[model samples]
Target: MRVLMVGWEFPPYVSGGLGTHTYELTRKMPHDVNITFFMPDRGEVSVPWMDIKRIKTSIGFGPYMTFGGSVLKESIIKSVEDYAKEVGKTAKQTDFDIVHCHDWLTVMGGICAKRENGKPLVFTVHSTEYDRSIGNPCPWVMDIERYGINEADGIIAVSKRIKEQIIEKYGADPGKIRVVYNAIDSSSFDCGLKFKPTEDLILSLGRLTLHKGIDHLLRAAKIVIEHHPSAKFVIAGKGDKFKDLVEMSIDLGIEKNVFFLGYVPQEDITKLYARADVFLMPSVFEPFGITALEAMAAGTPTIISKTSGVCEVTNNVFKIDFWDTEKMASRILEILNYKELFEEMSNNCRSEAKRITWDDIAMQTKDFYESVLR
Candidate 1:
């Protein structure tokens, strides 16, 4: 089986979970399955397992872009279109048994490829516009998503929550959608580097956005700090909400307790996960929270929103409503104050995360591809 994968980010060029997903999934594919991966030409990525084809576009936009200006917004919109057009042209010449794409960004290319080759088109919905925009989804993006949902031969949703969203939002056929929970490679968290903190560190790492529920986490931090005064809250990753979240911490009087580390490098990620006393993922509409898994795999006790797709798979992490700051703070304090509970959770999560591996994910994906082809 040959797959032509249309995606945005992969491995070293990643801005978020989508890149990690692509890299892990592709590398673990069955030996019989040939994958020719197509992505925007950021640089060259060579691997013995698969053939990578870089598609060049003049657009300079990236994933999870912050909307600071109309010019930037317009540029990003044009970039996606331009990328799709370029990908379509490339796909027409490439030979593959199936067309697979991630998110709306690559749907057009997938559609074009399917049209040209009459092959099975599989669209994977990592997230929707509603998740990104915090309920107010962009019509343009939504339109594209709807079209992809309707056109695809099969759909893969990262979580049951995402599958439900597709059905409810776009009236997609439930039969065509399969719920495939994302997996983590436990070995990836081992870099031999450690970040020893002077104080108890509470970490929240992701793109700073409205849907991330960072503001709610900040509100919870104020309460947590009142109890654990020396505890430090770290918000890592860059987004449009960076300045807003900083102001929020100040307004809540927890400025002294919080540290905003913008755009953490890939190498330091494992260290941050290893050293953090507890990892917080307070997303308002998280389709699937991969960071929560990464933290849990590192044996860091994780506190996640109930709405997260990851919550559906794991019982090792603490679950709470995104708006419940009081409960969020209480959970943070529970892990901080209690040694036995923390150790038990830490030990159990490490074991639990290892059970779900990318090899298993690749096999399931291969099965899905065969099912779609049938």
Candidate 2:
């Protein structure tokens, strides 16, 4: 099958997890399927089966203003319309069998291409605006998301939680939505048994945002520090909330124990994961926790919140509620203090990581695409 995939970002130009998902999924998909990945920009790396197409849409002042406030408005609508026209032209030229849109960014393009080409449209919802914003909802963002969910022939949700959110919140048809968990490339993380750092390091990697619940991790860090004074927490990633999180860390009196290693590159992250004793993800509204899976692949025992989608996939690691910093810290201490439990969870994490290979993810995705086409 020939597929034209539309997404907002790719690696090196990534703003979120969607880019990583697109990159890995296309790389592992069967060579039999011709996949053209259309994004705003291309990355430095190359994929053999994946054809990269760049589409430029100029966002005017109004769109920029709305984007600044995290609101999608008239400018966003105009930009999407322009993006759709460009994608429609590309679809006519390439003759792809199916059009797959990654998120709301590509919704307009997907709808235009599907209509113009008379091909099936497949949409993947990484997360909804309501989920991300919680109560302070932006009407325009929600409207765009709803339009995409309603227009697509088939939809893919990263987790059961997200699927349920779509059904309950957006009123999407349950029959059309498929739950496909995100995956990691284990081979890249196979740097075996690097020496553990002399200083005890607890690692957290993700965008520095309110939804990520880094403050919750900081609270947990304070609790862990009481047990293991040597414990140092390293947060890697940059976001709008970086300064706020830094201030929160100071106010909690765990500033000395925490280091903000902003935006570690992909290569360095793997090495950091190797040296760490535990990976902490305390996201309040994580649709799917890819970093936790990556940590598991690197043989690091992971502690994730029950709210995350990764909790739905694996049973080997520790799970705690996002608000329960005490329990989170206790779990971290348990993994750290007890060698037997640590080794057991570590071994199980490594074993479980193998099951979530990109190949398996690709096959399942292929099934979904074919089902939609039929």
Candidate 3:
């Protein structure tokens, strides 16, 4: 199968999980299936089996943006227009069996590719606009997502919750939407990690956004430190809520206990994940928790929100509500203080990660593509 893959961002330029999913999934794809990935701009790296097509654009699409910014909206439209025109030209020249798009950022071009080539269009919804904006999303972004949901021949939802949202909100046909869970490549962590009782390190890695429930993590940090003063909490990654989260940490008087390492490089995140005693992701409305999986892959005991899609796939890790900071703190202490329990949880979660491979995700995605094609 030959696929014309449309994506908003690729490796080294990705801001969220969508780009990581696209890169990792395509990286593990079989050699039999040819993939021509169309990215908005050129960035570092290249890989086998897939040809990266960087469309010339007149406008820049920033990796990060606020939906309320008019200039950002205008630039995105101009970028889309340029990308769609390139997709039209590329479609005329290449023979692809299907057009697969990731998120609303590239759906416009995916729709254009489908129109130009008349091939089956597959829309992969990593997260809806509602999920991103915390219930109040940009209307135009919602419209783009709606069009992709309504027009595409098939839809791939990263989680069952997201799949249900599409059916209920967009009134999409249920049969067309398939719930394919996100995966991680555990082999990337080359150094073997064992349970070494050292500094009680609590790590939270993700975008510091309102929906991520990072503030809740900060609130929990205070309680954890009050109980266990020797503990240290590290919150990594950057987002719109960075200033707000920093302010909250100070207001709560836990700034000393919590360290905010703004925008840790991907290369360094693996070391942080491996070294941490416990990894916590307290997302109020997370689509899926990939970082938590990465932590587990590195032998770190993880605690995730029950609302996360990652919870649906595994029972090994501790699951709790994002709002319950006290319970989250208690779990952190439970893992940190108990060596045997920590080792068991870490080992089990690693085994679960081993079961979830990019190869399996690609095979399942390949089957979904073939089903739609048939």
Q: Give lDDT per model, in order.
A: 0.87, 0.83, 0.85
Model 2 per-residue lDDT at 87? 83
With candidate 1 superimposed using the best TM-score fit, by how many Å does residue 263's alpha carbon deviate from the native?
0.7
Residues 246-310, candidate 2, lDDT per residue (tens digit)? 99889888889999999788889998888898889999989998999989888888999999998
Report the error of model 3 at residue 277, Å.
Answer: 0.4
Worst 10 residues of 1 by lDDT: 190-199
Instruction: Sort the predicted structures by TM-score, highest score first.
Output: 3, 1, 2
lDDT of 1 by residue, 1-374 (tens): 99999988887787888999999999898999999999989987877888888988865666665454577768777888888888888888888999999998889888988988889999999999867887777777889899999999999999998999999999999999998889999888733323333458999998888899999999999999999998899989888888999998889888999999998997787888988889999999888988898888888889999999999999898999999999999999988888777888888887788887899989999999999999
Q: How far is candidate 3 from the true structure (C-alpha RMSD, Å)?
A: 1.5
| Residues 205-236 of candidate 3: C-alpha lDDT, one tens digit per residue | 88888888998898899999999998899999
**Number of the candidate with higher lDDT, 1 or 2:** 1
- Give stretches of model 1 more than 4 Å off: 66-73, 190-198
Which ten contiguous residues of candidate 3 have the minimum total lDDT? 59-68
Q: Model 2 reaches what TM-score against the true structure?
A: 0.93
By TM-score, how accurate is candidate 1?
Answer: 0.96
Best by lDDT: 1
TM-score for predicted model 3 compared with the true structure: 0.96
